[model samples]
Target: MAEKLESIELALFERLIDVGKLLERRADRATREHTGIKYTQYEVLIRLRNAGGEIRMTELANKLVSTPSALTYQVSQLEKAALVERVVAPGDDRGVLARITPAGRQLLREVSQAQNDMIRDAAVAPLDREQVEAAYAALGALQRHLRGEETGGILPDQAPPEDTH
Candidate 1:
């Protein structure tokens, strides 16, 4: 049983790495051709949008799987495009928050739809919806486990964080 479990773990790790590489390649190609923004930037916009348009820079960085400096660079670019603005956090002058502008929301809507369509066409269309749901559930459980939470239940307030990798 121990050997079998190790084999399963190794295979899962290999498949996950392969999937990450393939998705990154495909997403980069699609975004370059259609959105004019990198996949990671779009992910940042989505994260901001989902957080009700603004969130602390550190919080956003955590959600984005990015470093503060890297996120700062991305946010700077977005700010120049008028897609996002950085504001000193109220009451905490030292903290910064990234706010998605109306333009950012509009762009997110357009690009998100296109990106979803592209992903569905290229990936989801090949999978049974039930299979996809099963995968989502299993991955969510794994995510919670990896985060050091107990297995089997995710608290209402402990919903999985968005993966912007």
Candidate 2:
């Protein structure tokens, strides 16, 4: 009985990861089709926009769960495309901030409807209201626990403070 229970728990964990990857794959394909940019880049634009169109580089990395080097590469690409710009953080000579450009905002606006439709079809349409709510609650709890209460908040735009250590 213990072995059976363990198997069930393992399956749940695996399925959660699988579903997340599957969704990312689908979103990536759709984002590329609509914007000529990878979903990863698009996500950076989204995060910057959510954070009032600018955020510290370190904080953005934390929000994306990405390495600074990887984000630097992405930001460089976006900068070349004129979709984002790197600016010196106010009052901090050593700190940089990533800000979404008007073009980035326009791109997001242009693709907004398609992205919404794709998400609704792929993630929401199949689930009933009750299932959606239950999943949201469960995932919220899991995200908070995994990300820590200090880092994860009720809204995605609520960024944690930069790590000083």
Candidate 3:
């Protein structure tokens, strides 16, 4: 029983990693073909758009699962392309905010349409609605678990907080 359980656990974990890799590869290819921007850049634009068109740079980095320096570089590149702008945070000389511009919003609309078409046609066409819902539930639970949410399975990454002495 123990060996069988361990085998199932390993298989599930490995398959999860593979699924992520495959999805990323497909997203990158789709972005390049449809939007001419890297997948990560489109993701940043979407994040900014969702955050009311502007957010603090540190917050953006956290949302993007990226480092501050890396996000700064990406934002600088986007600024050069006239897609985004950075302003010093109000009354905070050390803080910066990244705002998507008109051009950025337009780009997002185009890219989002393209991505929607691709996902609808290429990704979701074959899946039954119930299958898709189940997959989403499983993945969402995993995400919550990793973030230490009470709703999930409390995986290793969700270790209990240490009490201050």
Candidate 4:
């Protein structure tokens, strides 16, 4: 007798979601313990740093997967903590950009170093270097596919449309 078929799609997606939640929880706890900032705030600061310390609120909110209102609240919290400030965009007084202060950079450096230290102290050995590199390449390709980049028609099950609605 064969085993009865079930919801394989649900199983796969649920497993992936569960793993993501676990990873996020661990990161949040670790970052909060060492940097006094939640993972989301740390991610915001890191993105700002990568953007050369200034980015429009709309762009930041999109990257954060948050709404403008919610992002404003977060920015206000950061501003109150003296870690970030709003500045007028050059040539556009109406446009506001978030700029990390000198103090914010110092804090980001401290927080990043601490996180790196924690990761290193985990004592986990890297997988095969060649395999890891290949995996990264594959992931980049997969990310492109997932992000709606395709040359030919993709199967519905292979690539679901992104929900921007």
Candidate 5:
């Protein structure tokens, strides 16, 4: 009985990872077909726009689950494309911020419908309403735990508290 339960748990975890990768690949392809930018760059632009058009580089990196160097490279590429710009954060001369350009916002606007359609077709269409709700609730719980917020999750827009040490 214990072995059966363990196998079920393992299967669930593996399936979740597999589905996430599969969906990401599909989304990447759809995004690239609709826009010239790669999905990673598109995501950077989207994150910038969602964060009121600008956010500190470190914060952005954390939000992206990416490294600072990786984000710097992406921001540089976006800079060349005129999609995003890096600027000194106000009141913090040492801090850098990533700001979306007008072009970035325009690109997002143009691709919104296509992105939505892709999500609906690839993700939502396969599942019934109840299954969707259950998955959402389960994933939400997992996400909170992973983010170290099972007790009380920090809002995505809020900055994490600074470490005293």
Candidate 6:
């Protein structure tokens, strides 16, 4: 006789989709509050900040997973805000090196802190330490995988245990 699956397991796919949407929603809400910058812009800014110096337009585009034209547009906006600036690359007159300005650093710091605070507060809510740690670990790993990194690989049995009792 086939055992009937519980409601939770029966709706596994739906639950996965719901969780994904909820995560995105939370991220969107937080980013909007910190700055009007979208996640894409934030990512570009973060990359420049991480570089600790200027980056060529092509490289920035690659890091942002965007095209040259799109990167140019975002860079233009950031330039207007004095968040980023462009300069000539040494030995390459045609190359434009984009760098984050002091004001941009300040803005990034503020936004980063706010995002962190939000996550820290949430970690203290509803979920226990183990759940929070697992979530954080999973998110980081997934992010890396999506970026085309060489992953350590996930196993079928290593998935989060479903509540069935």
> What lDDT does the true structure give each of the candidates?
0.77, 0.84, 0.75, 0.70, 0.81, 0.71
Model 5, 74-148: lDDT tens digits are: 999999999898889879999998888888878987998898899899989999999988877888798788875
Over 4 Å off, model 6 = 1-25, 120-165
Clashing residue pairs for model 3: none
Clashing residue pairs in all predictions, respectively, total 0, 0, 0, 0, 0, 0
lDDT of 4 by residue, 1-165 (tens): 977657995696687578568767877888889867777887777667766677899988876678999889878888988888998888998999988777777786576666766544431235566865775566567557765432212222343322221
Q: Which runs in model 2 stand beyond 4 Å of their true positions?
A: 1-5, 149-165
Q: After superposition, how far is residue 43 of candidate 2 from its true place, in Å?
A: 0.5
* Tens-digit lDDT string for candidate 1 (92-163): 999998988888777865776677788897768889999888877877777777764323232223434432
Q: On a 0 to 100 scale, what is the lDDT of residue 63 in model 2?
A: 89
Candidate 3 per-residue lDDT over residues 41-145, each given as its tens digit: 877777777666788999899877799999988888888888889989989999988988888877866776677777676557779999888877878887677
TM-score, structure 2 vs. true: 0.87
How far in Å is the alpha carbon of 70 misplaced in model 1?
0.9
The best-first sequence of candidates by lDDT reads 2, 5, 1, 3, 6, 4
Q: Which digits, one per residue and each the tens of the lDDT, describe model 2 over residues 1-165?
A: 455568888999999999999999999999999999999999998888777788899999988999999999999999999999998988999999998888887898799898888889888999999999898888888878988633322233254322221
Error of 4 at 9 (Å): 6.4
* Clash pairs (backbone) in predicted model 2: none
RMSD of 2: 5.3
**Ten consecutive residues with minimal summed lDDT in candidate 2?**
156-165
Q: Which regions of candidate 3 fall more than 4 Å away from where they truly are?
A: 1-5, 148-165
Q: Could you say which candidate leads in lDDT? A: 2
Best by TM-score: 2
User: lDDT of candidate 6?
Assistant: 0.71
TM-score of each: 0.83, 0.87, 0.80, 0.71, 0.85, 0.62
What's the CA RMSD for each of the models? 6.1, 5.3, 9.5, 10.2, 6.4, 11.6
lDDT winner, 1 or 6:
1
